[model samples]
Target: MAAVTAMLEELRDMVPLTAEGAAGRFAVQEWTPEGKSRDGVETSWHKDGIRGWIQKFRSGAVRVSFAVWIRDVDESGCFDALDAVYEQGEQALATFLPGIEHSPLTGHLAEAELTATDKDEFIAAREWTLDERVLTAGVVQQDTDLPVMVVVALEEPAPASA
Candidate 1:
């Protein structure tokens, strides 16, 4: 998981300033409508603005890196408003991860032992090749005027078996 750690450090640098040490590690682009009020006074509604932050990191060999896209209304208690968004994103990532039989080792799969079993079963049980190093992650929250990005850190994986 050294790759994961390196990405986390890079993300730490990407964190937006307003995260108040929350460390977003993302790129933020906010969009909102500018309009005039009843008195013809110009104003931009912070809550009306659509704010989003995206974080992505990938290394030379590894294909996929942990990523998060957060979009929400900017206002007091916005964190409360984004609770569902965070939960949904987290759950989706969890669902896409590989299973045990498929990920027993890192980057290499167990050789397809030739067994005189049903061809269908053999094919079904076959594992897809992928980085098997388990990634561990953490998040940190912040309070700032700009979009917040929770810092995500990954734990290093054990050395792979030769």
Candidate 2:
């Protein structure tokens, strides 16, 4: 099986976003499930931890995506956590990065952009319990007419049994 490191490395070079750039790449605002003003406050993220990642695919077009997790390595499902983040990120790309008229297999990037703002916002809104966590976010700057989507999912740390 491909080691996790290799998978991460592949994703690292796939897009123009650095871990630090997640904040600026997407203008994500947090909201309550009830739909109230979130004020844009963000949560803290540990350095050297797997905050998240972004990926891109190019064929006739280019597609970009992002996925992030803001939690300690243990409480979250080690392998499962990373997998879920990756999938969520890919889904986001499928929805938001491909431009309105483009497809993942046929979309193209109009420019190079990156940010960490979205990741931080997600961390702030997340409410952890044990087996699951909830996250909220928004996407800005999509080329009208194309079908682009951004998805943000959170996984809370598992609670102790004792």
Candidate 3:
């Protein structure tokens, strides 16, 4: 949990995030597309620009993600948009995990072939072996104003044996 909290702070520097004051220690209330952090400030979207937050998790896992939304994206710029999201995800992951920064991600949507994961959602991801845990950087593709959500999933370590 400490790591998660620390990352949240780190993300604040890279991009706007839910305010711990209103969102509580590590949680943020749902927000709107126009931009609204639980902190009562618009920290989510920026007129089709960069947006980010600490994703709510049910289990003992925590993840931080950020993306840039471009309105009116045609097929011509789909791949570029995907790569844009991927870039953000890679950058966010590097914020906490400095070691992986120098080592470029293995999977890249621009270079690798990918199929639609959902109706209109295309996804790309890569894994990094970080000690006893695994770090991942993923991007989700959407239609219209494409939303590139790059997720940096960080999970809580296992508890010691009793």
Pick by TM-score: which candidate is best? 3
Candidate 2, 56-152: lDDT as tens digits: 2122121222222221232444667644544554455444332322322122213222236654433222111211222222332233232222323
Name every residue pair that clashes in candidate 3: none
- Candidate 1 lDDT over residue span 46-141, tens digit each: 222222222222321211223232334356656666565456445533443333223333333333332343233211122232233223221212
The worst-scoring run of ten residues by lDDT in candidate 3 lies at: 106-115
- Residue-level lDDT of model 3, residues 14-96, one tens digit each, is 32222343234323322234535543533343212444454433443334444432233345666776566556655644463
Question: Which is superior by lDDT, 1 or 2?
Answer: 1
Candidate 2, run of 10 with poorest lDDT: 29-38
lDDT of 1 at 126: 25
Q: What stretches of model 1 exceed 4 Å from their correct place?
A: 1-65, 68-73, 99-134, 137-162
Largest lDDT belongs to which candidate? 3
Q: Kindly report which residue stretches of model 3 are placed more than 4 angstroms away from their true locations once superposed.
A: 1-49, 68-72, 75-100, 103-122, 129-134, 142-162
| Model 2 segments more than 4 A misplaced | 1-76, 99-110, 115-162
Ranking by TM-score: 3, 1, 2
Per-prediction TM-score, please?
Answer: 0.26, 0.21, 0.37
